[model samples]
Target: MIYSFRNSGFRDPETGVYNQTYFMEVFNREWHRHIRDHQSLALLYLCPHIHETVKQPHLLEFFMKQVQEAILRTTDLVARLNNNSFALGLFNIDEQGTQIVLHRIEEKIELFNLEYGKKYTSHVDYELAGYTCTPARNLRIELIFEDVESLTHELEMEKNKHIELRQMQ
Candidate 1:
């Protein structure tokens, strides 16, 4: 049987990216597949820091477009976890490979800022938490998720401190 996404609840309405539910489902399958195939998988959590005042629907769309362009492989998947946060699943990639992809994404955002920075007065201060693992008997998805979530939260806390400092200055 073929599955259609029209009513599948697998996509985010706002960003048109895969939803968390779809990501989780795919992640489980991919995990086992990697174990069987002896491949690697990388997950990246990205938070793009768009100033609260500059919130725009089109901006998010543009960011996601940039993300798609940055992804090296057609097999990689990008999903929207929330308005400002996104998750990327990179298949057949090790830790070093994940860094290369992350760098490319950062470069794209830098170029984007060069074009829109003047008007928006806010750049993409991204917080990226990445993990790469070969599927194994001991690999626990929850632990990886917790680590990334904690890292993302730490970055947010740091960003908030800087924002407050700038406001006070």
Candidate 2:
């Protein structure tokens, strides 16, 4: 996250993490830097698939906490894209590294839910789009976010289709 010593307004008021505006600035800078330096960059879109029936106000905050904790490296960034959705930027990491970070966050959430039991419920699904295994493509940071969001939406559709098919069975 690009921290401006000039002002603290870049941070999300709720999660105390970088907001989308700050994230975009950092993403533009980082994308250029990565291109010049031949480094890897990845962005993960995390969405908490919370149903409307589960009205837990603190759920998003708690998940954001888990995300903030999981991304320990100063180079990594956590941003609140909106309510119940977050964006994590991983620099100097390829697809494998992104998966590792995702799993780490998942494990943390699982442990939290296990300990809290029925009183609290925490669940999330994520999608990742980043540099290819080969670093030859030039892409925009916004496209990465858009790609992941589209993939996540498609996955949700497939999952719902499966559920309907099973019901018919």
Candidate 3:
């Protein structure tokens, strides 16, 4: 929503949102703006359950729609990442605001699951990771992106540990 989707280069044709190339462009500009304005910026990286998505090809679209609806701010945006994952950016939002949006998304997703389970006898699952960049000196955009990506790995690890624990029990 940050830019006009009319330009094919700026948007992913299928998702009709910003593509990875455009995302980095905006992120770079936003990084400088964040430094100048000293405002809070939150980035969320989401990876839909690929296995489930294979069974339900529309699952990613449904999840992305929920995320888009949850983030109502004009300044907030969602972009397509590699491997069917996505990145959401919220500018001028603090940690609490970020948490609220996350909760909103989770609630919507839970509702979708409930309805889907009742009607289709299936459930959707996804992994989410978030990081907020506060006003700081000498912060690099590359590192922030890397940190969020690393968070994805950490979340997967935690999920696997839980699975292991459940198997043990």
**Superposing all C-alpha atoms, what RMSD in Å does each candidate have to the true structure?**
7.4, 7.2, 6.4
- Candidate 1 lowest-lDDT run of ten: 160-169
What would the per-residue lDDT of candidate 1 be over residues 1-169, giving only the tens digit for each residue?
A: 1346684588776566788888888877888899899888887788877777876657776777787789979888888887778888888987777777877887788788887787767766777777777777677767766667776777677755311100000
For 80-164, candidate 3 gives per-residue lDDT tens digits of 9876588988888877788888888778778877877786766766777778876456766777677777777777777552110
lDDT of each: 0.74, 0.63, 0.72
**lDDT comparison, 1 vs 2, better candidate:** 1
Tens-digit lDDT string for candidate 2 (69-153): 8777898888888875677778877766766776677677776666555665544544322332222245545566666666556
lDDT of 2: 0.63
Clashing residue pairs in candidate 3 (N, C-alpha, C atoms within 3 angstroms): none
Q: Once superposed on the true structure, which residue ranges of model 3 sit more than 4 Å away at CA? A: 1-7, 52-57, 135-137, 160-169
After the best TM-score superposition of candidate 1, give how far the Cα of residue 72 lies from its true spot, in angstroms: 2.4
Task: Give each model a TM-score.
Answer: 0.83, 0.75, 0.82
Ten contiguous residues with the weakest lDDT in model 2 = 160-169
Clashing pairs in 1: none
lDDT winner between candidates 2 and 3 = 3
